[model samples]
Structure formats: C-alpha cells, structure tokens
Target chain A: MIELHRVSKVYSVGPVKVPALREVSFRIGKGEFVVLTGASGAGKTTLLRLLYRDDLPSEGDVEVLGYGLVQMRRSQVAAFRRSIGVVFQDAKLLPVRTVYENVAFVLRVLGTPRRDITARAFDALRAVGLSARAQAYPAQLSQGEAQRAALARAIVRRPPLLLADEPTGNLDEAMAGEIVDVLKDIGAGGTTIVLATHQARLAVALRRRTLTLEGGRIVKDEG
Target chain B: MLGFLVGEALRDLRRAGRVAVSAVVLITLSLAALGGFWLVSSNLGHAVAKWRDRVRIVVYLKREPPGGDVAALLERVRVMPGVAGVVFIGKADALRALKQVLGKDAGVVDQLPVNPLPASLEVTPSAAAVTPEGARELLARLAVLPEADDVAGSADWVERFSHWQRLLTTIGLGVGFVLAAASILTVTTATTLILHARRHETEIMRLVGASEWTIRLPVLLQGMMQGLAGAILALGALVVTHSVVAPRLEPLVSLTLGLSQLVFFTPVGVVALLGAGTLLGGLGGWLARAAREP
Candidate 1:
C-alpha cells in the first residue's frame, strides 16, 4: 500500500539548504503494524509527512495507496487524504469541542449521515476507551485521554492507513502503554498502522516490525 | 452539508462575541451615514427639479408702455425660440401680487407713498431652455429688448442648487467609501482573530480531509451575518429618524418648496444598502481566509 524509492527532502531556510531525508526507500504492505524509531532530527516526521503527501520529495518517488504523490493535483491530494488518517504528537483536538464532537468531526467532514455518525463515533470512542469522557472538552482531558480522543478522531472515518507521528511522545510510560494497546487493537481490526517514535524500548516491546532511521537513512529494518 | 455549514457559521458568529457585535455596529454606522446622505441628496434633487421647472427670465420695462406697444412686445416675446409663456405685469398688478406674497406684511408695503416696483414681462422658459446654458441664452436675448431696462431670473439660484446637489452626492460617495473600508477592515480583523483562535481545529480538520469549503464557508457566513445585522439596524435607525423628523419637518419643506411630503428611500434603495453591507462583510471574510496559511 506504500512505496518510496530513494526519496530525499531538502528544506531551504534563508540561504541554507538543510536535508531532512536522503535517498531513503521503504515499503509496507496492507494491514501491517510497523514502528519507526529514531532519535531527534532523525527525519521521522519528514518521512511520515512524505507518506501523507503533505510534503513532496526533492529527489525520487513516493507512492501511497497506488497514487503517485509527485503527479497528484490539489483535488487529488484532498481525495487521497480522505483514505488516510494522521495523529500528531500534540493530539491537536479542537479545544472548543467535546471529545465526541472531535471524533464526529471527521465523519461530518466525510458527510456521513447524522444517525450513522452517532453510532460510529461512539464505537470509535469505545475502542479508544474514551466513551465515558465523550462529553469532556480537550482542555478538560488528561494528556493520555486527549491522545486517545485524537486516536478516536483519526479512526472515526475507518481510514485504510493510519500514520501516527509520536502520538504518545508526551505521555508517561504507563499511559503510553495503554495508548499503544489501543493502537494494537485498532491494527488487529485490520487498519494498517505506521507509528513513528523515538522511544526505542516501547518500539521493541510493541513486538511489531521495526524500522530505524539515523541521519535521514534507514539504519535497520527488522521484520 | 448545508445544515452543517450553516450551523458552523452560526457557532462561529456566536464565538466571535464582541468583535462581531462591533462589526455590526460599524456596518450600521457606515450604512446609516450613507443612507442619510442619500436621503438629503434625494430631497435636494427633487428641489432642484422643481426649481428648474419654475425658471423664468423677467424683463423690466423702462416705463409703462402704451397698450398697443405692450401687446406687440408680449406677442414678440411669446414667439421667441425658448419662450414657453409670457405674462405682462403692470405696476399696479405687480404691487397687488407683492401684497399677496407678503401676507400680513402687506401693510408695510402699502405704506409706501409711491409704487416703486417695475412693470415686467414674466417669461417662462420651455423644458429645453430650463438648463443653465439654455437659460443664459434666453436671458441674453431678453436683455437686449428695446423696452427692457434690466432682466433678472431665478436661473442662477437654480443652477447653484443643482451644483449643491452634485456636491452632496460626491461627498456622500466619498464618505461611504471611507466608512466601507473601515468596516471591511474591522470585519477582517474579527475573522482573523477567529482564524487564529481556531488554528489547531482547522489543522485537524485538514488532517481529517475536510473540504476547503467546509472550513471556509462558516467564516464567510459569519461575516455576511454581521453585515446583514448592521444593515437591518441602520434601516431601523433610518426609519425611526424619518418618522420622528419627517412630520415636524414636513411643514417647513412645504412652506419653502411647496412639496407635500418628505420622502424616504424607495424599496430598491433599501435592497441596495443591505446588499452593500453584505458585500463589505463578505469581502472582509474572503480576505481573512486568503491570508490564512494553507
């Protein structure tokens, strides 16, 4: 479902050209739960951004869900995005909305029927163990609970691919374990998951295929 | 989709709070000022038209002409190119007309030992000759008449009134433009504040594949609502102003210009004012959205 051939990313800051990814290539089949581990500035975020087609590669090709990122138009990018979900490090839930509304927002964007949205949003919240806090606003939630709410929002649309970039980066070890278990359940339900993080021990304990990035290149791939 | 868009718009408007209220107030003020000037200009235009139609050239004879000569001169003036009608006013008849115009002040006029008014030919000009250029031409012709000592008319005053009407219109437009600009800026600022406050939500929306319009339509609608509210308030204010002032001012207007009643905006004017307000708000919202980082 995903492929990148020697992809490289260079960001220009003033007169300097900084490389984020260099000649990196990877592939993940459908319904796989894969973890990406790297230190800070190891290009984990850039790799995830490329997979979501948020940023284009300076050199080489990227293919996600059979659409060539380089050739995609703006309309196609939007259409492509509907089939994939992203979870940011900060969770990025709307502070003004309750947890249920935050999850239902994705369904609303997809124009699901209100009746269906109610059922599906509740189910997604249940999966994340956030159904009890459905009416709680993001500001009122604990960091772990907010991340879980963000997870519910991400999966509300039942996207085929889920890309999480350090979703538990700010949580305690216990909270991180709980969040990862929820992600494991989501993966068991057949959604492909690509989780990027710098937590080496958590990545190993998850017991999934792990890819390590160091200086924008894949240093190890353990299937 | 429509319900969601509209619901989000209303929510945004509610969230806008003071900024939105201030925007409505600004719009109301802008449109009120605009409508006020428009009303003045309309009334002035009516006065100008009435005065133009009454424009005439008065030829003052050197002395009372013989009856036959008076008849001959009247016939000649009536046949002139731009002359609509001519009435010969004799000295006694002119004095009687003056007494009628002066009302209770006629006793002061009657105290004069001698009839000092001039015997003149009151020359009414045709519609085509009521213009500044046409009136000037006709006046020049009347001035050279053999029986004329001096010629005078209200044409100059009519022309001045017309100039004042034009000037009022220009000033109204200038003020309207400035106020509209201010309103647009205020609305833009309000929308930008909302944008900044909701930046996180917007980013999440994009991540979840929300359409561009799903994100933007609410902001546009919020702006439109502000504009519409402002226009409605301004219209309300205008109605109250007219109602309170029109009755008291009606007699003054009638006494001076002989108009039966004061006028307000026609239905078309009301629609245009509301449309202008809405457009101003829409423009501000659009600018706010355009300035957002995609």
Candidate 2:
C-alpha cells in the first residue's frame, strides 16, 4: 500500500540546509497498522506529510496506494487525497461548526448524495463513539471527544488508508489507550493505518510493527 | 455542490462581519455615484434630442432683395445642402415681428424715424445639420452668401449644452473608476481577513480531500455577495433620490433644458449596474484567493 525508497527532505533557512529526513526508506503491505514512534524532532510528521503529498521530498521516491508522490500533478492531488484519510496532532475542527456538521463536512465536500450523507456521517461518528456528542461544538467537547470528532471526519468517506499524527498527544493515559483501541478497531476492519506518536510505550503496548526514527533516519524497525 | 458553496460563502461573509459590511458600503457609494451621473446624462440627452428639431439659423441680408428677386433668392437658399426650408422676411415684416415681441413697448419702435430691422432669411436645417459641427459648417456656407450681412445660428447654445453633457459624463466615468478601484481593494482586504480567520478550517478541508475549487470558491462567493448587496442598495438609493428629487427639479429642468419630464435609468441600465457591482466584487475575491494560494 505504501513505499518510500531513500526519501530525504531538507528545509532551507537562509544559508542552512536542515535535513528533516535523511535517506529514510520503508515499505508496508495492505491493511498493516504501523506505529511510527520517535522523539520530538525525529521527522515522523515530515514522513507522514510526504506520504500524503502535502510536501515533496528533496530526494528519492515516495509512493502511496500506487501514486508516485513526486510526479503527481496538482489537479490529481485532491483526488488522491480523497482516497485516503489524515488526522493531525491537533483536532482541527471548525470551532463554529457542531461535531456532527464537522463530520458531515467531508462528505459534503466529496459531493456525496444528500440522502447518503446523514447515514454515512452518523455511521462514522458512531464508529468513533461520538454519536451522542454530535450536536456539541468543538469548544464544548473534551479534548478526547474533539479528537474523536476529528477522526470521524477523517474516516467518514471510508478511505482505504488512514494517517494519524499524534492524535492522542493531549489525552491522558486512559484516554490515549481508548483512542488506540478505536484505531485498532479501524485497522481490524481492513483499513491500512499509520499512527505517529512520541510515546514509545504506546507503540509497544499495541504489539504492532514499530519504526523508530532519530535525527531524521529510521534507526529501528521491529515488531 | 452549488448549494454547499453558497452556504460556505454566506458563512464566510458572516465571519467577515464589519469588513464585509464596509466593502458593501464602498460598493454602494461607488455605484450610486456612477448611477447619479448616468441619470443626469440621460435627461440631458433627451433635452438635446428635443431641441435639435427646433434649431433655426437666421441670415440677415444687407438690404431687401430687389423686387421679384426675393422669391428667386428664397428658392436658392432652400436648395442649399442641409437647408430644410427658407422663409423670406421683408424689412416691413421684420419690423412687425419686432413690434409684436416688444409687446406694450411697441410704441417705442413706432417712434423710430425708419425701420432699423434688416430683411432676413430664416433657415431651418435638416436633421443632418443639427449637430454643433454640422451647424457651424452650414453657418460658414451661409455667411459667404452675396446678400448675407451677418449669420446667427441657435446651434451655439445647443452646442454648449452638449459640451456640458459630455464633460459631466467624462467626470462621472473618472470618479466611478476611482471609487470602483477602492471598492475592489476593500473587498480584497475583507476576503483576505476571512481567509486568514479560516486558515485552520481550510487546512482541515484540504487534508480531507476538498478540491481547490471547493476551498477557494467560498471566498469568491463572499466577495460576490458583498458586491450584489451593494448593487441592490445603490439601486435603491438612486430610486429613492430620483423619486424625492426629480419632481422638485422638473420645473427648473423644463425651464432650462426644455425637457417636459425627468427620466430614470432604463431596465438595461439597472441590470448593467448590478452586473458591474457583482463583477467587481468577484474580481476582488478572485484576486485575494490567487494572492494567497499562488
């Protein structure tokens, strides 16, 4: 489902070329739930961004779901994105929109039929256990609820691949474990998942294949 | 999809709040100024058309045409280019017309030792010669006539009025353009603010596979809505002003311009104003989006 061959990304600040990812390489088959664990500046976010085509690697090839990330045209990027789901460290829900509206927003943008949108949105929200809090605004929801709402929004279209970046970063231990359980359920349903986090214990606890990165290079890959 | 876009646009406009309101106000003021000038120009155009038909040029002769030659001279003048018709007036007839014009003061004209009035030929120009340039050309031709002493045409005053109308239109266009530029800039600023305010929402939308059009169209629509609102308000202001002021100004207009009644913009003109406002607003929105995205 995904392959990155010697992908290297560099950021330029004046005269300095700061490498975010240096010769990083990985491959994962369909339906794999992979945990990308690393410290604060270990290039986890950069790798996910490259996979989602949000940023281009300065060198090497990155492919996801058969699309060559570097060669993809701008017009094709939106269509490619629709085939996958992405969640950020922050649950970027529109503050003014209710949780339900936030979830339904993705379907609306995809031009889903009016009749199907309610059913699909509700199903997604129900999957994330946010059905009861659907009408609550993001500001009113607890941090965990807001994150679940964001997850519902990401998965509403039933995209085959899901990428979550530090989704449980702000949650307590119990809340983080609950979110992982939800991610596990989603993965069990045959959606490929990549969850990035700085907490190594969470990756070990889940018993999933984990990739550890340090100084912009993947240092370990083991179950 | 269209409904969703419009909804998003409305939401953005609401979010823009005071900035949106200010943009609309600017548009309204600009359109109103332009529409006001158009209204005045329309009335002036009508007056010019009406007065053109009554334009007359009088060619005073050095002396009365000798005996039977008066009819021959009248026929000659009538056949000249742009001459619609000609009437020969003898000195006696000129004096009689003067006495009638002087009304109760006719006794003063009777007290003169002799009629000081010159016999003249009244020349009515055809439609082709009604224009200031056309009248001047015809006047030059008549002035060179063998028996012509002095030639005077009513075209001069009409020409002056036409000049004023043209000047007003030019000034109106200049002012309207400046105001339109200002409105567009205001709209751009307003849309930019909304874009910044919704940055997080936009990022989420993009990540969720929203198309570029889906992400950007709301900003454009917000600007367009502002323009549309401004256009409607401008039209309303113009109608109210015309209704309240036209009647009071009609008498003066009639006395000066000889127009029987004042007229407002035609249906086409109203549509044009609305279209212009919407286009201006849309342009502003498009610019803002382009600047941000590009």
Candidate 3:
C-alpha cells in the first residue's frame, strides 16, 4: 500500500530551486499494479524514490507499506526498505558477484538462516527465469539477463511491495516485453507493484492502472 | 556474520593494494622505533638499579686516626642515619689496594717517595639513601665530620645515566608519536580509497537494507588488519635485531652500565605495542567512515 498526500519536492542547486513534484496526491491500495509513465525530467524517479523512503517529500506525507516516510528515523529506513523491493533502471549488480550470489546477497544481509537462503534465493531466481544463469557474473550477462537478475535480487525476500523505475529502459521491444511479462507474473501473485517507465506505448500495452506525469505534475490517471 | 565481515575486510585490503601496503609499512616503522627505544631504556633502568645497590660514599680523613681512636670513629659513623656500614681503610691498606688495581704495573706504586693515599671511611648507604638527593644529604652530613677532608658519592654519575635514560624515552616517544600520526593518516587515506573503489557495491548494499555498521565495519577491519600486520612485522624485526645485536653490545654494556645482558621488551610491553598499532589503525578507519558519511 502506498499513499502520498499533497507531496511537493524542491531540489536546491546553489540559489536556484528546482521543483520536481508539485502537490501530488495519490492512494494505491494493496495488490495493485500501477504504472508510472512520464517524460525525461518529469519526476517519475523522484516519486518512486519518495515511495521507498530514499528521499523525504519536501512538503507532504508519504506513507508506504505502513511507514511514514517523512517521520521515519534514519536508522529505521534500512528496515523499512527491506520490507519492500526496488529495481532501478540499471541492474546495479555487483560486478564481481555471480548471479546467484547477487540474489542471495539480500538474504545474507538480512541474516537469514543458511539453510533457508539457498532455497529462497533459487526460488526467486527461478521466478525471474534466471535460474539457468545463476553462475554467471554480472559482466557476463546480457542486458536483459542483468535486469532479470536485479529483479530476482529484489524479490528474493518476498517483500509485499515492489517498485521498478525504468526496469526495461535499455532493452529492445522483445526483451522489454519479456521483462514486463515477468513483472506481470509477479503482480499476479498478489504483490503490489509500482513501475516507472518513459515508454507510453508499453504502459498502454500493459492495460494496468497508469499514472501519467508531465513536467512534475500527474496529467492523467486511468486504466 | 563475523566471518563475512572478515572476508569483506580482507577483500577490501587487497583492493586497496599499494595504499594498504604503505600504511602497514608506516605502522611498522613507527612501532619499531618505539620498541627500539624501549629496549634501550629498559636495559638502562636495569643497570641503574644494579649500580644503585652498590653506591658508596667515601670520606677521606684529614689524617689517619690514632690507633685506639679508629674504633671509636668507625662506631660513630656506623650509627649515622643512612650509614648501612663503615669500613676503615688505613693508608697502608689503601696503598695495597692501589697496587692490586695496578695489576702488572705494581712497581709504579712502590716507586712513589711516600704513601700518597689517604686513609678513609667507606660508607655504604642504605637502599633508601641511594638516590641522588639522599646521597647528597648523606654526603653533606659526613662532610661536617671533624676528621673528614674530602667527601664524594657515586650518585652523581648514576644520576647522569638515569637522565640519559629518561631523555632516550622522551625522544623515542616524540618520534613514535609523529610517525604514528603519519601512519594513521596513511591508513585513513587507504581506507578512503577502498571506499571509493567499492562505492557502487556499498550503494547496492545500502539499497538492499544493509545497516550502517554492516557497511562500515569492513573498512574498520581492513584498517585493523593493516595495523596488526605492521605490528607483527615490527615485532619480528625487533626480535631479529635484538638477537643479532645484543651479544655484540653486552661487553660494552657490562663495562659501562654494569649490566650483564641487554633486556628486550617484556610480554606486557609487546602487547602494548601491538595494541597501540591496532588502536591507531582502527581510529583511522573510524575517522574515514565519519568523514565519508558526515
């Protein structure tokens, strides 16, 4: 579940104030798949960042998965983040780690028991169809495979909410379609998903609830 | 979790490469300098203790005590506050001692026109009176004796040797502190480099919900490892230097300081040095984390 009420974000770049979002209000219910579509510099990334508590809203409230983003302590941020999954545009996998290690890294960090980590990590990898490439390093993977590995890492702990920011930004149509299908499959399993992408056609093709942004304002919200 | 941290620390150290090595070398140089000075000071302390037990004040008499009066004089000086005992050395006995000291040159002492040696009472001071101040006080008391001509105590030279020992300690500490500061800085720089090298990995870790301690501890451990390695190497160098150099210096030490052997650091001292290195390294790493984040 995600809720943002009258959220406004202004970034300061040396005496100049750049407003990235203005009075945005939205409520996303449980188990909903919402696509966030916008042009470059239209604040899609900023909005997702707020949802995950990476950046606090400048002048409003952001409540994601029961955490009040503006009021959460810095120490509590990590725990809150662990309760949700986030996939960036770039896969951002550790270059030296194998795909399996990358996915298992999250479980290891959370201090999951050794016996449970293997099964859980492999399950997540299988869910993203990256089980066959588990042994490959990030450098060895294709762009699409890297993104799939990132998805596996995100969902490894089976968080209730998943946020993807441009998960298919660099892929071709067929590869992008493959990633979108995987996300759809994940959504079908009852995980609340908020995905940000610049591709409008992709948003229309998915036929999910979509929030369209133009120049830091949500211009349209429709299914 | 501990094993994972140690593994990450070692990996970071390897990633730091030459900067890490330089930090270790700097710590080694600093610790070695400190240990070397400590060795010298410890030996000097032993020599000071040895000689303090043997300190004697000699009161040269204006004239030889009349035969029957010698006993009275000895008894009188014996009861003085710090006088442990008194030995009366007559002129003839003094001449004989001089000839004994002359060894093969005994004929030179016999060639003198008259017995040039003065009769004296050798006063052995108690342990409490062996210090420079105590000896000076005792000498002052004896100088006022009616039969005393010249009074001298061995405390002055012993005090000089003690001064030299303290100076060595102070100098050693000064040098060690400067080198230690440099080593800590070098460790900080090395850790900073590793942090930059692993920035992407760290960001990913943070995003994945790794706690600040989890993200920062490896860097701290890396610094400590560097420090620990340097300390071990420094101790090794010290041991080799001591074994190879102690025997060659013992004869001179025995002649000058009256010590039969040079003493290296005690076990406690060794641990202190190692602990200092580790602490310095840890501090550097902690500072790096503070600077990087804050």
All models: lDDT?
A: 0.90, 0.92, 0.92
Clashing pairs in 1: none
**Candidate 3: regions farther than 4 A off:** B60-121, B126-131, B146-150
Each prediction's TM-score against the native?
A: 0.85, 0.90, 0.90
lDDT of 2 by residue, B48-87 (tens): 8888888999999999988789988988889899899999
Clashing pairs in 3: none
Instruction: Give the worst 10-residue stretch by lDDT in candidate 1 chain A.
Output: A70-79
Q: Give the range where candidate 2 chain B is weakest over 10 consecutive residues by summed lDDT.
A: B153-162
How would you order the candidates by DockQ, starting with the best? 2, 3, 1
Off by over 4 Å in 1: A13-16, B56-126, B139-154
**After superposition, which runs of candidate 2 have C-alpha atoms over 4 Å from their true positions?**
B60-79, B84-121, B126-128, B144-150
Q: What TM-score would you give candidate 3 relative to the actual structure? A: 0.90
